[model samples]
Target: MEPDGDIEIFLVASPGLESVLCEEALARGFRDPTVIKGGVTIRGGWPEVWRANLELRGASRILARVAEFRAFHLAQLDKRARKVDWGAILRPDVPVRVEAACKGSRIYHAGAAAQRIETAIREELGAPISDDAEVQVKVRIDDDLCTISVDTSGESLHKRNHKEAVNKAPIRETLASLFLRRCGYDGGEPVVDPMCGSGTFVIEAAEIAAGLNPGRSRRFAFELLAGFDEAAWAAMRGAGGEGVDPAQITFRFYGSDRDAGAIAMSRANAERAGIAGLTEFRQHSISDLVPPDGPPGLVICNPPYGNRVGDKNSLYPLYGAFGRTLLSRFAGWRVGMVTSERGLAAATGLPFAPPTAPISHGGVRIMLFTTEALA
Candidate 1:
């Protein structure tokens, strides 16, 4: 908040997938990312915040810590908050929404805490406070200490602005990217999602292979912050040069579903993502799914579970057929799947190794079940 050189940057992950997100952040060249309950925290300045929002595919959102202080009471909090250099990070013209959480703090009421900060910002910084604003300032009071952070990503990173059509219960692209990484996918080979609802897995795989930034097509909240340098941001986005050319991408991504509407959605999404040239979508059932005309790669999907779709009792045979089809035709290809029930995954009999930590999606918990190359 005082325009200090470096600030704490937290990359929020899906509730139970912090470890996987940490792995991705480390692999993406973030230094010594430490995993916490909800996210991975690192130390960096505005540049790192921008890069994280732009490049980290697994992060649901990025939060930049602006200030921290110990305040046992609401009046003391208001006094300290008024002293923060809100002008350094926030623009007077752009409105902000304040959200507060209290835990083990003398100031036990979250509403009062948020009101104090809101009044401080409104009176001292001259910024309007609104209930619905793209810029969010979060106040966390825990153990008598208050931490203020700004949400740098306006919309969730999963909303790449690429997919307009979606399935009833679809896997988010951010989670799909992490699941792909957990399956040891590094953009070196083909990827197929047999139950592709809206082409999330296939599109994410294509983007990874092409070395495209997930936030390439979208805007972020950081752009609305004070002292945002547009030229510098443009240079940063182009620093690594453009993505791998579609022509150079020899490997193809395939997605198919029994529903023709899903196939159309996938095709449209792929086209919007500018990867349709290197992707193929078809309307076909799982029984017709087979490896593309190339080297074996990874087969990953988020199949229906009882909590999201059809009845639990009716899904076992679907899982069985999916497993049988893979066993019969997809030797040497690795598999990754997301399902809520262990029994349904067991029905596949795919010999998946231990599953990753359960991930929170929609409302229920699901795990990414994976296996090495099929024997």
Candidate 2:
């Protein structure tokens, strides 16, 4: 939680979730977020870290930079690593796990480098080291320049510690949050997921509408660091817990799945997230979907592609039917559809513009298409 200099905040996301990472950085008030290969890097302090963890649903983990130095080999690494006051960052009593990776560097042996760093932390700083550790410190040496990060989030943020029932091709919570943002989900408009599997999108939408922090109920590994601000964290958690409206949602979210079991599981997950009352889950096919009793709203869905189903050609008729139903039944409402196969999206017949960007989810590359002519 260094407050003086420019601190680095690393937001971990799924393979195809980079765009959402940048969008989240902007939404959370970060200026000019730059997306790297797999994550987003931004400059902020402890408050930003807290907000990112609490508010962002697309990030897998939020890491804070504690120290950085340049070293060509083990000797140089030992000198630089010993210079830093490790006691200020990690406590002597708390156990820690150290992981290191070296790429294109003179220090080719990663294990030896990690061992040297571990020696400095344990022997010099008196911190205990173990395989089963709650706090973890990661070291990355790229071309002889070392960057160390403290894993503020011990466990992956997607765990959320809530979902036990999942779908066959279930989408991760992080991906769902990003997809929702790319589709311009602002928490004030009605959202519908005709093929909602496991109810992730609908539940996330309801949480946004209810002003619930996505990370409020989870615990972080930073809590074990030395000089950790327990009172300040408690105050922040308490403040976040307040101002919750159990029944003051701004919009209605609807989700439906053809699978009866999926609908039942979605209901249970929504209830676990404390949004079951606000969300409606039903067992119905996309052909049977009708507009909810409200004004023209947003219809967002992640339809099945050939990845899990049998033949790609066989599902064209289903997509065509879905498109025909939308074209005929629901006019003047926006439709956002995500699919990996271009032909599958084309099968929908409704004229749609190509997605602004592409994202990778579950080892599949997916893009979004929105109908320009909602009417």
Candidate 3:
């Protein structure tokens, strides 16, 4: 990997959700992404890598190409690692952490492999290696081919630098954003989360509407690299806030939850995201989801699936009652609901056509049901 024009990026996603990440990458202008078991790999320039890091709500981390070589043993790995251009990526003063893993390869000793790479980086590049360092260099050896990548995202994208308050089983920002995109949210119409827990969807929606980049408030490891371009990054940060005013947006975002504590957390999270005024929170139940006084909009909800003890039988009736309420009152509104259990979704019985597609939510296999306005 010798400073080629385009960089190879690995877009990591939730388990069994590689296809969804691929679809999202394609939608975001990634060309011919290769879908692997747990992630999608794409080739792009530095700008694309930065934009993907900032805009891609589904990716766990965006890795950049540092180097690659073919090594059959430890000696060969050491020789090849020493000959590469480390000055291009790592400064001699900046400390780094080296992580290595081997799979289906002759070199099966992960600890020894990591030690070799760390020694090479330290001695050859003069870069300090530390245990608690933020900069990480990853080495993967598979089938006698060794690949090296740097973790561009220091912290996971889900830690959006906000959300000081959270509730039990809170929805991840990436999953919530993906579900919203799947529900066809174009930042044009009103939205609601009847069972909104911490207002993840509502805040993401407001950010999308206000043209705020999801990654603007956070920092990445790439920003600390040797040749990091500060001017280019500033331009990229400024690009997200164009042509949108939250005040003029006609869409009225709302959230409601049975737990008052959840509402308080949701409000606080919204305020931290700077979209508190753009969204409304209320302590209410599913039965109170009357159609908005304005236009009929999408109602996206990630209700509990009763996965704990004593939760199954007790929560089923809540699902049934929610279904009855939607059928009786929300006749002309579009409904998008996510739940881990198919039985709980089937309990809705809102006459949905079928799931658009199933997505992974919080380590469980979940399906989504969408229904158009009732006739």
Candidate 4:
């Protein structure tokens, strides 16, 4: 595929959350994004690809679908793959890794397909192919159709570049942002995470409230592509940063954890992300959680499940105490809790509306349980 024309950009979503990512893409003004099975797709040029990498918070990674063709067998695939204009998108100086997957395709050997594409790129584009390359070329052969894409985001968007410190089994920023959206959070209201390990939710909330772009601090694989325009990318980023004044944001995001080290890490991460002034991190257990001095807001937490940290029998009391604390002290506040165990969530006794579709986090299927404002 040539880089001179409009490109199909795919925003990778965590499974079961494609609609949430689609909502974000539409809100961000991406042109005509359609929700697909695994992700959301939009059509645009290289600028759109760069902007998607820079402005989107919910996407795991952005892939630019550059080429699609019919290849009934290995020979056909090899011939067509060599004809692709790799030089238009790939750089000779930058290394690339080619990955291929086949399902119900006539040419079903994924390893051989990948090797063919790797050889084509190496011989045709003069680009080095390495397993460790940050630039990735993905080939999917489904039912004899070959689709090629480039992973534009070098690292997962969850890295966010500024969160250097993390607690055990911290929720990824991408998943946290989607969960916040699912709980009906916009930037207008304050957010509190009671069991804020590494403060993923709190920090993400603060950034969203301040109108900070999630990708502002990071570099993308697209920057090394042949079609990269540094000046245009810089202008887009500048415009995004100009939209919100962090100093003017009135609502404060709060996070509390029993471990003092987690609180310290949260504070440091907030500081690095430029939202420290808009957030508060304190060392406190779930039982000690209290609503800050403000109007009612959303309280979200990714607390531990029995499988991860402790035994289920011992955790029941913690959940019960958590439910009791909110019931007694946090009137008018809403709650969102994420846990892998249904029994643990049930132990809370909070009237959570039906749980969201289960999301995979940290290798376990978890769901978000949300409640209306407490009476």
Maximum-lDDT candidate:
1
Task: Give stretches of model 3 more than 4 Å off.
Answer: 1-4, 30-34, 353-363
For candidate 2, give the lDDT. 0.82
Ranking by lDDT: 1, 4, 2, 3
lDDT value, candidate 1, whole model = 0.91
Once fitted onto the true fold, the runs of candidate 2 whose alpha carbons sit more than 4 angstroms away are 1-6, 15-19, 30-34, 242-250, 308-310, 356-358
Against the reference, the lDDT scores of all candidates come to: 0.91, 0.82, 0.81, 0.90
TM-score of 3: 0.92
Residues 1-375, model 2: lDDT tens digits? 343336788888775668677887787687457898778888877766766777778898988877888899899998898887788779999998888999999998888888888888998889989988989888999988998888888888887766789997777787777777877777887888999988888888888778787888888887888767778777877786733575665558999989998899999998888888789999988889998887777788888888766678888998998899889988878888888888899999977887746666677888878875376
Pairs clashing within candidate 3: none
lDDT tens digits, residue span 86-199, model 4: 989899999999999999989999999999999999999899999999999999999999999999998898989989999988899999999999988988889999899898
Clashes of each: 0, 1, 0, 0
266-319, model 1: which lDDT tens digit per residue? 999999998889899989888888888879999999999898455888999999
Candidate that beats the other on TM-score, 1 or 2, i.e. the better one: 1
Please identify which of the two predictions, 2 or 4, would achieve the higher TM-score against the true structure. Answer: 4
Instruction: State the local distance difference test value for candidate 4.
Output: 0.90
Of the two candidates 1 and 3, the one with more favorable lDDT, higher being better, is: 1
Question: Weakest 10 consecutive residues, lDDT, candidate 3?
Answer: 1-10
